[model samples]
Target: TGKAYELDFNQIALDPVTGEEQGRRMWGEVSLSRENLMPFLYKLHYSMHIPEGFGIELGILLFGIVAIVWTLDCFIALWLSFPAWRGWRKSFAFRWKQGGYKLNFDLHRSGGVWIWGLLLILAVTSVSMNLNVQVTRPLVELFSPLTPSPFASRTPVSLDEQKFPGISRDEAVSLAAAEATRLGLEKPAGGVFYSPEFDVYGVGFYTAENDHGDGGLGNPWLYLDGQNGALAGTQIPGTGSAGDIFMQAQFPLHSGRILGMPGRILVSLLGLAVAMLSLTGIVIWAKKRRSRVLSDQRRRHAEPEMQAVS
Candidate 1:
């Protein structure tokens, strides 16, 4: 057993570093926000069932969901964050003057540290224009002069107000295309979708392009002129704007897919970790509750017999 090539049970290490670590691959290098760190990762957190580019309304909903998860994660995070919490009997809200300081502060700090990793992922990823890159890397190569986004401003078109019948869908689309070309946007990737509520046939365009012309590799937005085909102005998806490119990428980064498959996998893994930590914390709490109940019952049952001296 001295140094033979044959297998030796006690000679090996339990946890081995992966090939990635050997390659010196770091999340920070590709991340736009390399200042933070997260030890967890998950898949669904990187890719979800949600439709793409739904907008801020959906964003708020997502926020609510993650917040709830974070609160639950606190128990797990707190456990990992503060080993001393095991002995903490005070309120999670500590107050020095009232002698409640120890309890609250312990819970607060521990809970914060537990979710801090997740928070870093969320915060850093939300600002990237496209989630196609890592937080440490720019999603797309930045232009030196930083050309104005083609879809930045809308070209106005005069339309028939009372259905004057002068303008047709063809004219509207052609005008949109022309204006798009003029402003240097990729050919219109979207067509028209009429909304009854608005009474206007809006011209739409998806932003997906490999040539890297106007927007990034996402879907097209819209331009709503009148049925008379008068251009009100250029519009973007989810309230379209040249500024939207940067904004949309942020959500993906927060979810962790901005870098590619690896990033998505990492985010998904983190989600799983958060889920596991929550479940474990709940079980631990339940076990403690059961133990307390048994102890209370045993003590109460033995109480009356101990009154001998009195």
Candidate 2:
């Protein structure tokens, strides 16, 4: 299947070699294909190769918890960075002249302090992405009203009970295109997606090059009823309530695509910084622990000497 097809998800089943419409394939069959390396990696990043079983997505839940912990740790680390108000500058200063332990400590503490806001954003957005329904939506709703998500608002049917769309994919796209034009959106319909669980068709509008809707709140998506092809809901980025917009920004912010290429570069560097900080932290802990153990051993040896002398 070296032949490239259109970006429409509607034709996901189209055999590129034979030019025949094949039935829908499983996610692994498509995502794990030779041509879909990025998609496979993206899936691995969030899901960590965990398969869904027993009505639980363990990978998502575990990552969500980790994000929550990371979010709280950010605040704790910030507080620890400023132990004394007068010497607070030390927290942000790197001891470049003194290498080894001092430099490691400085990198771990100062590096984190320098990019604390970005770290917090990453942590919080991670939670939003991993646990939108379980945690983020509830928390956002506490402060601001959120427009109900079409996928979440509707009742989900089991795979066995899933109903086929009454309207064709082309019909759904046409309805979505009409809605996009009505709203004065200029971007063409870039992709079409169907949710079997919710029985909804989501039509995304953007340029081919900007499929992810990089830069500024991402792209607009229209959710249509699969049965009637009627507009069910709309997600026009940057055009909603405070809570709604915040919810929409989660994926873009998490992936650092909100600022486009520059943001992606920054996020990649930040990832390295995070890794460095974690390694330095472990080194610091090990050094301290070793020191404590040596001190305790010396004290024990001295106690025996003191007893002998007595």
Candidate 3:
């Protein structure tokens, strides 16, 4: 039901030099050469294609809850499937001699047991992101230092605040760059965004000097006051509070970017495994139902013959 951002021709336009901007045929008309499925997948995964905004929100909330509950169920199933010390070796092996149903059952059970940890991590993180549950914040806070407080510059300005003359974006960027070097941020400056809500310029950059230098999460950020080139604070991932690190890790982990290419491949394969498990489960149920129906039919036919003989 959802469409890609690139396909929203009404809201977007193409420029010869800078493509895809807000306007209609400013420089030249743009056309799609081929179909792109990334946007479709994104919308489907997030359940954002619902007719109305409220519907989309409701769908995400319900989905997050279901995922979390299902994750817990998977954990229970894995625990129940655990074999004794003597059976540990056999538990990992699949019996090829078994029939289709038995094999399916074993695959479902064994796969669940093997990948349950990853599934749980993904599920919990999904809940935290979609549901906005601060599960990690409290745990991290207990063990780590406090995160920097939000920007609170008392100096106020009118809504029509001038962008120039005070502190240019370039100045803010330079300060951020210097700060990054001092903090030993290995990655180059990611990018910068202007935040009107907080009247500050935010710069995002990555570093490989922290607890989770695996690059699975997003880069840390540096916040500077828009009015003047004053350093508000920096959210360096490597040196952040526990809560900050946890929050930072969510996006990368969710998208499989935290662990690089290998992590992405692993997550993709796990997704396929989940799909297979669901299909096999449905197949098993259907076969059982069909067998029950045949048994009932045979019993009804035999009942009349037995009565006549009696």
Backbone clashes for every candidate come to 42, 0, 1
For candidate 1, the TM-score is 0.42
Q: Per-residue CA lDDT of candidate 2, range 33-61, in tens? A: 65566656776777786877889898888
- Colliding residue pairs in candidate 3: 216-258
Query: What TM-score quantifies how close candidate 3 is to the native fold?
Result: 0.68
True-vs-predicted CA distance for residue 97, candidate 3, Å: 4.0
In model 2, the Cα lDDT at residue 62 comes to 86
Task: Give the lowest summed-lDDT range of ten residues in model 2.
Answer: 2-11
* lDDT over C-alpha atoms for residue 91 of model 3: 50
TM-score comparison, 2 vs 3, better candidate:
2
TM-score of each: 0.42, 0.90, 0.68
State each model's C-alpha RMSD to the native.
19.5, 5.2, 7.2
Residue 309 error, candidate 3, Å: 11
Cα lDDT for residue 133, candidate 3: 38
TM-score of 2: 0.90
